[model samples]
Target chain A: MARRGSYAKGVAKREEILDAALEVIAREGFRKTSVREIATAANLSQTGLLHHFASKNELFTEILRRRDEVDAVNASTDPEARFIDTFPMIIRHNSKVPGLVQLYVSLATEAPDPEHPAHKFFTERFEGFREELVAEIQEGQRSGEFNTRLNPELAANSLLALADGLQTQWLLTPTLDMAAHIEAAIESWRSDPKP
Target chain B: MARRGSYAKGVAKREEILDAALEVIAREGFRKTSVREIATAANLSQTGLLHHFASKNELFTEILRRRDEVDAVNASTDPEARFIDTFPMIIRHNSKVPGLVQLYVSLATEAPDPEHPAHKFFTERFEGFREELVAEIQEGQRSGEFNTRLNPELAANSLLALADGLQTQWLLTPTLDMAAHIEAAIESWRSDPKP
Candidate 1:
């Protein structure tokens, strides 16, 4: 009974740390946010924080996981809407969280190395995201909303790549309207209006 | 004079080092290639190579510059082609050198930091590239080769973003047909043929 109580406390503490980390990262850019700062914000020593996560990489990965959960919850609240419909909103939300976006771009570029600690996390994330996008695109095609000529897999990949690419650009040029560009690109893929 | 002769020799030596670095990076990929290995391939000590470049960032930046020169020479061999028309070919050539592509992606992501040595280089490169694309796109619009409704600036940005995004995906999944996707994307922008 004591062990179970301790386990629940540990889980609660972990959530507290993640929430603190997210607040710090969102307030300060990723490059400026340090683990020590996050730990301090969470009312833990650096070592105590490390005790919860295996390493900095694992901690950041979990932060991203937590972020995904938050985004999914926000996106899914509209039960009638599909993933594609909410993509632009997600991007807009991302624009408001540049720090997290920076973390994502940096880690994604690094995670291509098979031995990187976040490698498995990113690999599975990309695969799952692509699968979800493909399924959504195929549905759009069946409904004659998207051009049937478009390959669902390729479209999914392109959309994901475009979003990633736009984020990179947005980082450099903050005023770039990423969501608008995404909307325009999606419009290009829509089936041509009847003559 | 002797001084002039030595200056000429120094310039030649710099070219030789860049060529060697390019060869090494093309074969080994950006992550696996090291400065020492590049120095060895150029038949120079690391210090000797550093004499020609202010730092590793400058050296890699020069390598990219050299690559752009080489690509431009290839891309412009046929004077009739505009930049937009030749873009898919450039993407195809990029696919052949995954190492350089990886280097480009890594450096681009890093260069967003204002303090990064390559920041100015990328800023200018993006601006120049965008201007060239916009000019070519405007020319196509005038020729009725592209839809007049599409904003040239947005289209240029979209194309650049798509290419950058596709490169990111290609790094993760090697079998992706980036050029084919690019071709299809360009096709989508073409003006509808009169019935």
Candidate 2:
């Protein structure tokens, strides 16, 4: 019973660290933030923080995972929210967290290599994102919210690509209005002739 | 006369080095290709090769610039080719050069920082690309090759975003047919009701 209690405490501490890390990154920007800063924010020694993660890549990946979890929670707050509906909200949220966006772009660039620690996480994430989009797009088509003539798989891929591509551009030029560009793209599809 | 000859020689040597680097990178993936390996292929010592460029970032940026020049030359070979017309060829060509694609993504991710050496190159590149695309799209609309109602600026941004986004996805999953996806996107605009 005592051992199980210690494991539970460990998990709690890890979550606390991740929350602190997220807060720090969102505020200070990822490039300017370091592990030491995150550890200090979490009220743990650098060594103590290191004990929770296997490597820097693993820790960074977990930070992203934690972010997704937080976004999911926010998404659930809207019971009727569909995947397509939440896209603009997510992009707007991302704009406010430039540090996290920087971290995502940097990590994604490295994640393509099979040997990179984040490779598996990214591969699975892409697959899952694409699947969710495809399902939602099909549902939208059935309800006449989208053009039924469009290919769901292709549309999903294009939407995902637009989001990813716009982030990079928006990072370079903060005034670009990524959310607007994306919304326009989505609206264009809706205006297409219905099957 | 001696000074002029030496300057010409320097220019010739730099071009030779860039040509060799491009060939080597195209054959070996960017992550696996090293400066030392590139230097060896050019028959120059690493230091000697570095002397021709300001830094690694500069060298890589120049390599990409060289690629654009080569592509332009290829496009000019077909005198009637418009910017939109050559997009598929560009994408198809990119598919055959994964190393360059990797290098581009990695550098672009870094280039968002104003202090990054490649920052200016990317800013100008994006602006120039968008301008060219907008012009070509407008021309297409005039010629009845595109949807007249579609906004040229928005279409250009979407096309550029699609190309950038698709490259990252294709890098992650080599089996993805980026060229086809882009072609379909362009075709959709073409099929839209004429204004």
Candidate 3:
């Protein structure tokens, strides 16, 4: 029927546009990426691109939403685990999609702009991410696997920061042993100082 | 006389080019930032821009070098105390220049690219930075100001990560109590869990 054809076409257009955005972002960088170029990459006219999304910001939000969906699926799988496991997934996923990774890094800087959609996302992300992380640490505390004196919230923040910062370094040096580096971080936590 | 004239002109041209780069980076993200626009922004023809730097990579590197120099100067007055003082300095300085702060967060993500000139600079920067941080923690441990159980290297890494991560977040949310965040992180080394 006509309705079925239109629905399929709509789905195809949505995917094609995303694929184009991913390519454009990777080639041109996040800020320089124009919808025109994305339209070109998608084999659609600029008007056609416009027909799909209301604005560039909307397109970007869709990209972020898709990314979050993927993370949700991955994160939900192993709801219970040491941060050691979860941290690696983040790094691993990041490596696979360099364009998205660059977008994240680049957008993270722009997140400070009050008008940017990502600003709210990051604020909520940071607050929620920290709470979730601290809960994990507490789980470790419950099992007596971690030092009882370490503050969970502080430890969570530090660990998140370390993981993110280390990735920045690793992006420059792909060969950098991220897992090993994290292991070293965990070792530091495990090593009781000379009393 | 010709040499002197050229030198002054070159210096002015370089400054002009830098101004353009900053503007473009602020307007468009890093990758989208074009050499052509930078040249135009500086009121120079493409050839004029090429005369100063062979390629875009060089220009990017120079920008990073300049930033490093600025940071060095900021911390130069007390390089030895920078480990402890840098955190507070970052908090204070960031409020004054929001653009530079955003630039840093964005570049921090991009800086990891080995091909980026800032790669080795940041790598070596962190190594040296870490050494200083470790020394501070060790001194704290020795002075009985910090928990003797703290692993100096791990603590140092975590601290640096926390500082970087917190700085990125604060850039987006300027209202954050940066100094308080730092102090809380430091204080977390203690705070025994409930039985």
Candidate 4:
């Protein structure tokens, strides 16, 4: 068994490497950026970096997984709080972590190939996000806060799509107010209810 | 002035290269894809292809620019039709030309950097699309086909965002009914203008 001290150091080094990888990827892009560049950003030797992540894909894949950790920090656990209050921080954090945002965008587009590791990442990401939104919208309907006419499944998909789309615009403009846009969508949605 | 024979040949060659490029890119991604690969697919050579394109970027840029050709084609001849007709075909084409879809996905996300050549290409693309959508919504309102309370700009942006997001999902899951989802979005806008 690994010593507790060494385990803590390993975890710290992994996170440090992830932070550096995220920044390098955001600025240089995947094609242009090299593993050595990422190592430099993390203040480690190229060989040292490889010791942690066997390849660029492994590092990139880990970065994507870490992004969920970022997502989880702001993610509400109660599941009852309105989505309104829930995700503003996610937007705020996203702006600050443009690298993560850029990586998300880059991988999402390129990862569609069945062979790409991130192909499954984004695939699962959307599925989980869609299911959550559907459940939440359904819950809202039962609680009298949402429109019964709203097809939760359809609306959920649309909402998820809009979120992905907004990420592109936000990455470009950086000032378009993503969460505000999402709130506007919710407003648009709530305006019409089935009776 | 350029000779008529050369110009015609160049135009035809450009189209041929695009067709071949699309097929090759579907099987191999942008980076793995090469001028040689495209040339081989077109039954030409490195020099022959270069004679027509000058460079791959130039050729691909035109291809990317042509993204709106279908929408433009329909718009000029039949400007009075509802968005539903166009939105579905657009999504369907995304399904058919999945590689080009992948190409657009990768390029659009990365092009946000000012250094990227396609940056201005998409900036103009979004601006033009937004303008067209706003005008359409306004026309619908003036004709009493849409509600007055609707903000055409916001709705256009939302719909555009939703389309992008939904495409990401559709890419991951081959079974998704993208057109139906887009159709539902159109209905939401038409059902209640105030919402």
Candidate with top DockQ is 4
Using TM-score as the measure, name the better of candidate 1 and candidate 3.
Answer: 1
What is the RMSD, in Å, between candidate 4 and the native fold over all Cα? 3.4
Q: Write the per-residue lDDT of candidate 4 for residues B139-194, one digit (tens) a residue.
A: 87888777676788888877777778777777778687877788887776663534
Clashing pairs in 2: none
Return the candidate ranking by lDDT, descending.
1, 2, 4, 3
Top TM-score: which candidate number? 2
How accurate locally is residue B142 in candidate 1, as Cα lDDT from 0 to 100?
98
Q: Over 4 Å off in model 1, which ranges?
A: A32-34, B32-34
- The residue pairs in collision within model 3 are A31-B29, A112-B172, A172-B112
lDDT of each: 0.85, 0.84, 0.66, 0.73
- Judged by DockQ cut-offs, the docking class of candidate 3 is acceptable
Candidate number with the higher lDDT (1 or 3): 1
Ranking by TM-score: 2, 1, 4, 3
User: Evaluated on chain B only, what is the TM-score of candidate 1?
Assistant: 0.94
Error of 1 at A107 (Å): 0.7
Candidate 4: C-alpha lDDT? 0.73
TM, every model? 0.92, 0.93, 0.66, 0.86
Query: Model 1, A1-195: lDDT tens per residue?
Result: 467589888888888899888888888878736678889878899999999998887888888888888888887687777778889999989999999888888777777677777688877877898898898888888999988988888778888888888888888888889999888878877888997
